[model samples]
Target: MVAPPPIIVLAFFCGTSIARSASPGPARPAKPAPIAADARHKQLTFRNRPRVVRSGRMRRMNMSTSQPGTEIGYTWPIRVYYEDTDAGGIVFYANYLKFFERARTEWLRACGVDQHRLAEENDAIFIVRSTAVDYRAPARLDDIVKIISRIERLGRASVDFVQEAWREGTLLATGSVRIGCVDRATLRPAAIPPSVLAALRHGPGTSESAD
Candidate 1:
């Protein structure tokens, strides 16, 4: 056979090298985008971690304690209705007391103590003995305020609570209220029932030594 031309030999060698170098092996999927990579990492991390589902009461407790100027307590949300506002378009000052009252009631309910039931079954009733309130800021109409109620002192026949009203992280009002236990029929001072006392001491966001 005639010797191949030098140019043809060079071309053949180059083609063979390229074919060998470009041969397909195992295929790799494309790399993920940066965001996708981060998301995937988060997903894996979440899967590997223990999942904790907190109850509503626990969530409120955590939220109340995590913020500045907030005490560990039971929190309740209240919406400002038009009727709750004054002609100046701000929440009426007295309405904050109402808000505090509602929160305290809810707190007691959360403690598994029903006031009506307590009165009917145990002949026990709770009455507000005293209240001292300080208004810090004004809450406008339609504002949703969170009321935090914490036990300050547990007396033999009375319980004092420190209540605060917060709007969007701003403390609007703070009040100290004392609730006294009494006999529903006699209206005389009475000791808080053992069951109710136990419930209050073990209520959500409260420590055993709270009393």
Candidate 2:
């Protein structure tokens, strides 16, 4: 029998995470894209880009241009639609998870940790270990939220990421996630690849130690 797929949870947010310098590592600004005037146009509807989940994950192809394994982080811009809110038009409590997750995956992709590649070539997978969250305010439908992903720690077998969600320059929520690399079959922790670790250590983040 096939083993059960590991549980994967998304983390949200972008701001002053881990109190690190914003020098070196992934260099591009870790901020959200400015909303276009036409984002609300009918052409920008879900019909143009259907929301679908693949393998228990959101399918976001090339959401960012940064190469994988060494980005300051990835930025995901999401428009709040009617379906994302309550009768009163405020966004529900949980959709924030969806927003930050897309950003994290893009961050991973920017760092070159393709989920497929890690599984095939290295027999490794990143599993979310824990999440610490704080919800500050309610986001309204149609508001564009930006999720930022940046590293807090690179350890022997795990990496910690601090993410945040913002609406129009205001901090809305924050998340601290610990991700562990594990063996595909044994379900045990495994050391990250030398190349991957090296990239992350040298990649965009406020790394004060030797890089």
Q: Pick the candidate with the highest lDDT.
A: 1
TM-scores, in order shown? 0.66, 0.60
Q: What's the residue-level lDDT of 198 in candidate 2?
A: 76
Angstrom error of the Cα, residue 135, model 1: value is 0.3
User: What lDDT is obtained when candidate 2 is compared to the true structure?
Assistant: 0.69
So what's the TM-score on candidate 2?
A: 0.60
Best prediction by TM-score? 1
Q: State in Å the error of residue 5, model 1.
A: 99
Error of 2 at 137 (Å): 1.3
lDDT of 1 by residue, 1-211 (tens): 9999999999999999999999998889998667777888999998999887766632121112336555568889999999999999999999999999999888898999988899989999999887778888999978899888888667689887778888877889888788899999999999999999988888865644457
- How accurate locally, in lDDT, is each candidate? 0.83, 0.69
Off by over 4 Å in 2: 1-73, 206-211
lDDT string for model 2 (36-67, tens) is: 77875655785688676555542222222222
Candidate 1, superposed: residue stretches over 4 Å from native:
1-71, 207-209
